[model samples]
Target: MTSAAPHLSILDKPFVLDLFAGPGGLDVAGHALDIPSLGIEWDKSACLTRYEAGLETLHADVSAVRRDAFESLPPEINVLAGGPPCQTYSVAGKGAGRKALAEVKRYIERLMAGDSDEEIDKDLKNLSDPRTALVLEPLRYAIRATRSPNRDYRPYDIIVLEQVREVEELWKHYAKVLEETGLPDGTKYKVIVDVLDTETYGVPQTRSRAVLIARREGLGEPSLPAPTHRAYEAKEWNRRRDLALAQVHQSTLDEETAPEPEARQERGDDLQPWTSMGEVLVTPVGTHPGRDTPFLVRSNYGSSSDPGRRGVRSDQQPAFTVTGKISRFVVFQHLDESIVYEGARFSMNEAGMLQTFPPDYPWSGTAQAQQVGNAVPPLFGAHLLSAALGLPTLAPEALRKPWQPATEEQRAKLRSHGCGAADDCTARCPRPE
Candidate 1:
């Protein structure tokens, strides 16, 4: 139990558990907000990263974790936050894309049963469900154990779920499960996309991400906080300039401008493409004559890899989605002096800064670039939490920062030391600082 002297003038800090916390990006985000974090990650590297960052890490697969794990924590954990490994929905390669998305849905199904609705519905067997009976059995047990006879108040008041766009339907499904299972009767669980700009949050990159939020019953619908940055048209959404909880500054007209097809079933132009790589990735323009890394020297162009790829644009338009694979695509390749980081090098920390991590935040670990690529941006979490608590997010520092890029000499030195040769290593990340 963490007790504080009343004279200290601080409320008991909210506790957060990061499920499938890869590389502690979510943990850092919550920690920056001053929340106590307990992270569960199956990957050893991620666990080490979380541990190094001064977080409590449970080095075990979340699937293997049970309710017994919760008993080890101090009661009164106010928040549950994390994005489970998103292998199931990611549209990648031979592409073992997002494998967990289907599993999450199955997990939700099992945990969603109620006191009276126990009649297992049929026909669900054919469909692949992530949140299945097997996956969510423990959560179901946790809910059942908290019934009238047992006084286990296992009700978590808030949850910050971060997932992909395809998972939006999953949100509605999750909402339904919570309602039918009576999880939301006394709790408030809602999911909304809080797309905070990395640049606005003082990160040099123009990255974007989504956030999902939930509050235990009686806390009321959690506040959906607004963005602070305006880079790449985000600032334009500040119609009223309500700095406290201002929403994204983008025009909803882009959405309204989208010609609604005469038919309702048609696919819409995918929401104006997210901030692209050309806007963030370091170009090779200023790179040393001989120190050009593959990423640094890539052409300033899109790819044939995409269904209908667009070529390079001299105008700094959104380049394309910056996936985990940057050197392969989503990069400004070729030799040019004007590329963003052209001829210049970027550190893992610098990449993270573009991803919107706080400067003083020690991201201790090797394979820093890869770690930065895989993480969920922390500012997105900050925006969501700030919204839920109705707290002020007037900090200007979180929205913008000076860009940091590696010099040719530094890149040459690192390459000489064998750090540049193996750019694509799947090995474990180093300990977080």
Candidate 2:
């Protein structure tokens, strides 16, 4: 007798299990889309931020969680998403993951060969940076889910994974592995892998992330979401140069005759110009509220090729990639080296806003800058999740709107039961008594 076909429709509710989830960037998107999500994060500071935001979280290492724990959760999880720790592979850090790429590939081979977890764990411990092995945890979860012996087992309907651009090769290998090793029930996955630029999706930063999306065969082949905004171009800044001079050199222009560049302008064919720092930081989102002056950002860290020359970008451009060191960047009024902008360094809220998080997102604990910088932009995450589920993309206005604040009751709970109390306490903090 033939097994029943898997349910493959957007109408089916999607419950997300995000591994290595950091401060609810994707969870914020999930909430906006009205999807319930649970994130597993290991960092105390990140978990504290999640608590402040009222997002569901489990404060434990991804490797320590058992598949049976997931199997026991109510409502059932059908979606798997994660942006694993990328410092080892990032350009900003020592290239430990890059050096270990071949060894990592060998580990994948062992996993495919049905090697015991004990053997894999022993070898992974021997890697230069043990964190490099964490990238493979998602794959282990996927494999176990597909080959489950449980009578009611259902493999994830959608899988989304992202990392720094260097991990694109690994994601490609994952595509090959999933295709070659079909599900135990003979259903296969159609996978798409690519590097996505956040600015193209209307995020206010020009960050790129390697993304992989997989869906079961009956769900149809997955494709990357189409860009809804034009990519940021340096030439675009030249067009706005005179306007910046006008803001600084002359009185404010007449509102009716010459309006400040609108937050969004329609180009033909459902695309808008890339969002600028001025639109987010200077205007509506109000990183520098009530300030109409144009400014320039001086990056603290110079480019790889020119370490001596500091990188500079006008407010008209999308921000240079916001890194963990974002607090070190300095802002100036126009090109005048002598005049510092009133808000010289972006506040934590401003940095978070540039990452497409709401301005009021309650960032908690030390290393808040690192938390904001490491997060996936919620707007970009929303678009990816929508595309993976074959649903309509979120409205452009959704990106601009502020995220809802946590309820008073939720705030009281966080205050009363702090995440630092203990590991088990943090885990229980977000759940109902």
Candidate 3:
């Protein structure tokens, strides 16, 4: 088993409180970093998976949780992280949040301007999708942690947030607010926001997310994680495929066919090739019974350019964005498109693996597909968290390695940091034995 690189402990000791945490994607990354994490999620299905995995969890709605509630936890949470529900903002959904982007920004502006929750909630309740307003919840918590006059005002040292790419503008607005809000000590947060491709972070799917990372100025400069892997380009892949075909035909007439040069130069001096689905699914997970036979995946969703046509990807390429409806995707033997592959679709374990979850991850409860799809791939989350803390970049091999379950020592450390100890937890918060 390959071990992760030595963790560079930037913070004295970090405790993370994740909001709208679904099935512990970021939390898993946190565990790998030896950082204790507590996730608050409202989805019973996701919570079930969390419990089965023995992750620290508070199964409750983010909106219902008080902004200042972190004050009461046993250990002071220095890191605030979460990926808020992005259904309303995602293009695959109704696009209600996109439609209300301006209105939502106004709500964020009001929150930063000291608008009362009652006032914001009143108007927010009228949005087409109330979930659109929930995007502001992280900011609400941040404001209270930094500015609230409650006893012992302790500000978070770091704040990390992620959402669908459509929410990049809102994340920029968040960066603006966080940079302007100074802590009691007059030190402000250094903030950076960008749209990150999961594939660049070594995830086997090509999902894009808007990410914001902010660290207290005293800690050090904050920046997004550098991509460790080159992003996969479909056009480039197609071009290479056509060239290979042409070369094959010419080789019959000529004595020899010139070797195809590298398909494309690496994105960076040190970046590795983009990870393909075949690298993960074909060998480790055995998606195809014929070990040598390649396969093609027919995506359930359509592309922006061709809405009527279903998207297709070869096993040699990274998967299209994994979605809640991924179960609807079909797989075919590469040589025969008409015949469905033995494994027509991804199993729950296979689906979770595509999202960077461990193959043996315990996925319980209903809507398991949604749980897998909605997760921030743990591999990407690890790199993001490492960058936020001003730590060394995770080696590409570390990100690509299969996830292992938390060790007993890791569980003990989490308990020391107050995992699974929420007083108001509405669901089963299982303690590691």
On lDDT, the candidate that comes out on top is: 2
Model 2, 133-174: lDDT tens digits are 988988787766655545156778899898999999999988
- How would you encode candidate 1's per-residue C-alpha lDDT over 341-382 as one tens digit per residue? 443444444455445554433454455555666777666656
RMSD of each: 12.8, 6.1, 5.3
Can you give the TM-score per candidate against the true fold? Answer: 0.60, 0.84, 0.85
Q: Candidate 2: what lDDT?
A: 0.76
Off by over 4 Å in 2: 1-11, 67-75, 147-151, 183-187, 235-270, 284-291, 334-342, 411-433
Model 1 lDDT on a 0 to 1 scale: 0.46
lDDT of each: 0.46, 0.76, 0.75
Q: Sort all candidates by lDDT, best to worst.
A: 2, 3, 1
Which is the better candidate, 2 or 3, if ranked by TM-score? 3
